[model samples]
Target: MFDWLQHIADWLVYDVFNLSTEQHLANALNFFIYDTVKILILLFVIIFFMGIVNSYFPVDKVKNYLSRHKLYGLEYLMASLFGVVTPFCSCSSVPLFIGFVRGGIPLGVTFAFLITSPLVNEVAIGLFIGLFGLKTTLIYIVSGILLGTISGVILQHLKLERYLTPWVKDVLAQAQREQHLFEAEQLAFKQRLPIIWAEVKKILKGVIPYVVLGIAVGGLMHGYIPEGFFEKYMSKDNLFAVPVATILSVPMYSNASGILPVVQVLVSKGIPLGTAIAFMMGVVGLSLPEAMLLKKVMSLKLIAVFFGIVTLCIIISGYVFNVIL
Candidate 1:
């Protein structure tokens, strides 16, 4: 189906361009071209469909339903499950988080959605199933859900509502007053198409730069870095490997699909499965970009607490996987 893309990539790198296939620079550039194209295609298609689905669930109704439910556990679970289908990265999910807050959903429930959205995307799940088989994929998905749910429950118990930026409360208050003013009509298919396109464009503009930069770094590491480095530091025998991997992943930003190629390399090079998976989760679950976007709505203290809880859970999950798998 994408034979033309493959041919164009090959021609650009090796035939028309006359670059040597064996050179490190050529290989890196080729990988960059190929992966960038494929990922962008996936991103556009996924975002468009997600936009269409979201159009059906108006913010006011979502807020009304979620807010009315006092069952914290069920609410968290529902949020996490919704996160799986939406499959947005943390930065991109920020807008959705704002909407959730505007709808008057509990802070903890919003956190659950934010926490799971990036980690449990459909693309990541599909890729994992292809690479590691169903059993391991199930393990990863279940662990992600549990992590989001538990962390959310803890944060809820902390009662950190005041930690939201004042602007969020102001917006929520405004939204509340406006809720009774107009009932949202179901969007016609034609109307939904424009909304989907707009969403795709907006998300692409925000995410492409991060995706490109991340791929460049990963490409360099893939082509230039020696495999022995990971073997020495992240091997199963290294007691600190899990925590170390988790810590290292926090600053780097990449989607799960974007980072899986690097994770595959790490695992193949004798890095423990648990450590490699931890690193991937760290990138997907938390990053500097996500933090920056979140700063618009969350105080520094709340952000710190959120990351701390998530980090602890990921570390524990890594250890458990290492022991069992």
Candidate 2:
């Protein structure tokens, strides 16, 4: 199947399209444009439905149910599982975080949701399945959720609630200010569709540039990078590969969906699956943007702690996958 697809790809580029050196460059440009357009369309449809779900459902109910303080482990599991179904990015997760905080959910459980939401989203899962097959995708999903739950429970045990910014705490305290704001606004579902559409537009405006840049870079690396370069740096035999990948991925920002294709190429070139997976997770979950955004609600100390915990989790997950797979 892959050979057939590659044959078609070659025919289109080398025969019908007659791509020369200059044409290859143009084709690359066109690839980026097409990729950006496709990703924007997908994001719009997915987020529109998510917005409707957010508006119609009582998010407070989930918060309240999870806040009862009965079973920390179970609550963490549920939070992580919930994240798998919800399609939210770091920015989108903020409002839900605020709602969870205002609804009196435990700080640790809320952190679980925050961690899992970006790391193990449906789009990421689908892309993984398509690129890497079911086994690898399942490993990614399971490890991500495990990391979220474990990190949340650990943070709760540390009692680091005091590290939150004072203003954020105040926002939680003033929860009644906008309670029922959505419920009181009476609009038919059809009428509400436009609002969701507008949100999709705004989000795409912000996200498209990053997606374009990331994919273009990935395509260049895919087409031109030396096959053995990543293999030499990130082979299973290299003890330092996992941690190195995690550290290198910190400044970079791409979700799993954006990184999966690049990762497929890396694996084909003999890069260890564990190292590639760790790099992908770090890019999505521990980005500079996420850290900066989190600073609005947390002190530098808390942000540092969050990064450290996630980095450690990714490293450990890498090693585990290396051993098992």
Candidate 2, 2: how far from true, in Å?
Answer: 30
Off by over 4 Å in 2: 1-69, 176-232
lDDT of 1 by residue, 1-325 (tens): 4568867888899987788987777776776676567656766765565455445544566757855766748888888889999867666566667656655667888899989999998899999998888998999999999888888888888999999888667655544433332225544677557645754575567557755765565455445544334445577678999998888777666678877887888887778788998988888898775676666678999999999999999999999888788
Give the local distance difference test score of model 1.
0.74
Give the per-residue lDDT of model 2 (tens digit) for 118-220: 7898888888888878998888888999999999999888888899888556654433322344568867787767765665565456555555565566445
User: Pairs clashing in candidate 2?
Assistant: none
For each candidate in turn, the TM-score is 0.68, 0.65
Q: Pick the candidate with the highest lDDT.
A: 1
- How accurate locally, in lDDT, is each candidate? 0.74, 0.69
lDDT of model 2, residue 287:
67
Displacement of the residue 71 alpha carbon in candidate 1, Å: 3.1
